[model samples]
Target: MSEADYFKNMKHDRNDPNPFLAIFMDTSIPFDEEAKAIYLRDCSSKTRQFLLPLLRPLARLAIILLQIYKSVVPNALTSSKALHRVLYWGMKTFVSPSANHMILRHFYLGSEVLQFIRDNVPGVDVTMNPLKPTNLEPVKDDLFLIHDLNLYNFIINLNRELRDKGLEVKKRDRLNFGAITSTRIPIEPMPDRWTNFLDLTSAIEIFTPVYQMFLTDNDFWRATNSLQLDETVGLLASKIIGSNDRLALINNKHPMVPLTTLRAGFRLVLHGLATEQLHALLIELKHKQEHADLSWNRG
Candidate 1:
């Protein structure tokens, strides 16, 4: 058969009746392999000049606006350290600071709550610990956590979103998280599936007093009210789509990530509890996990 005819037949026979031939699907190249190849081909610096005309207007506008902003804003704002703080505050106040990543949001929230407990709750001594990746199956997921691009993409998208909403956002260099680390609370990772409940509780039992302190402290409530984190959680729940569904070939023997990913709903709510120590956080997680209704689906 001709090359074109072979490809046409391949498309049509994707659902071939013969099990042997259909099972060989594993050998086939990815559907987007050609598109990916084309994208990489056009990514060269020489090829990139082809789009100069398309970007000229945007580049000019950005340069003009930047000059105007720099001129009008106070000279104090020009300091790299001050500017970073301003940008970071804007991101936290207006946008979801965790890039709307469900799991990361939990870590962020947990750290904040722990810090609050340490600062305001008398007699409570909550220690901040680094959450290292676990030695679990599918090491790729752990590696994905270590990569910094996710954080960078979140910041870039945040700036884009703010600009779309009429804020004149200047393009800044890749943000350094270390600059803002002092402001962030640290949190340890939760127990993995392999960890027994008794062992898990033992590690986390220190948090019980912290959680109780949150319940009793009026200052804690005041702090949360000031941050308007409840609304932030609502906004995040509405914005981030949360589901744990996937498609797989029935005959495939080896599948990646045997379990569905943590649904956004659970992650967001869990973060709320971890960060805010709101009433009945655990209850909410349990209810949603059991029912997983449309409301929970929003996260």
Candidate 2:
């Protein structure tokens, strides 16, 4: 189904607007070229700006290396399983308990990203740190459903308005609460060095709140199991990739796109995405008002 059709199915009060919507929606935020230029000036780092572009090429190389590792390493390991078993037995027999603890510490880094995103990102003004992730918090189950419905209704109405203006929004098959059967994914707590930037952590911080603002409020209910940074990030990232991919479909065809160039910059991208979402919320509200007025006149 088209995004508008899918959104129309969302549960929300058609007559009343939620007051707390402002926490997620900021219609006043600027997203034009002038605002983007200013964001670059305030938030850009010279070294990062230079090195960031290079990552695209490195990403390609990493993919190749990963393919080779998966293909070659598995067979090699299988061939060496007997030797490995002997080595494992010898190591267990010889290695002390204290030595194992030290080895684990060497592999385990602190969960700084989780702590930083949860404790710091949401409370900070995005205008100042546009790079930070949208703040997502665990809410009461009842509250989650209410807000989720509100956000769903807002998007549905906004898409209808956009369609009236001759815009085409495609169906996005990204992750959502209704579609999600399970939230079990491999949790790699330590991200690759390439993604271990402050901007990534900041961007991740915004994921939950941004996602909740867009999808069903109860979409993150599965995450209540542990709220571990890796698992939560995994859930959030899946939705984010889905949302971005949906936007990409529109952007690919349209001559003018939002946040196309600066999207490579983590902070800039987060702001651009959040700005678009907030704009949708405002459009939805306006459409609701217009409909209300028409109904009143008809009465």
Highest-lDDT candidate: 2
Q: Please provide, for model 2 over 116-152, each residue's C-alpha lDDT reduced to its tens digit, 9 standing for 90 to 100.
A: 2222222222111111111111121222233324333
> What does the lDDT come to for candidate 2?
0.30
The estimated TM-scores of all candidates read: 0.18, 0.24
Per-residue alpha-carbon lDDT of model 1 for 1-299, expressed as tens digits?
42223233544354555332243233322212221222222222232344434444444444344445434542322332332343233223332212212223333433332332223222323234433222212222322222223323333454454556654322222211221122222322322232212211111122222221222233222222222233332222222212111111112112222211112222223333333322123223334444655666786
What range of 10 consecutive residues in model 1 has the weakest lDDT sum? 243-252
- Which 10 successive residues of model 2 have the least lDDT summed? 127-136
Model 1's TM-score against the true structure: 0.18
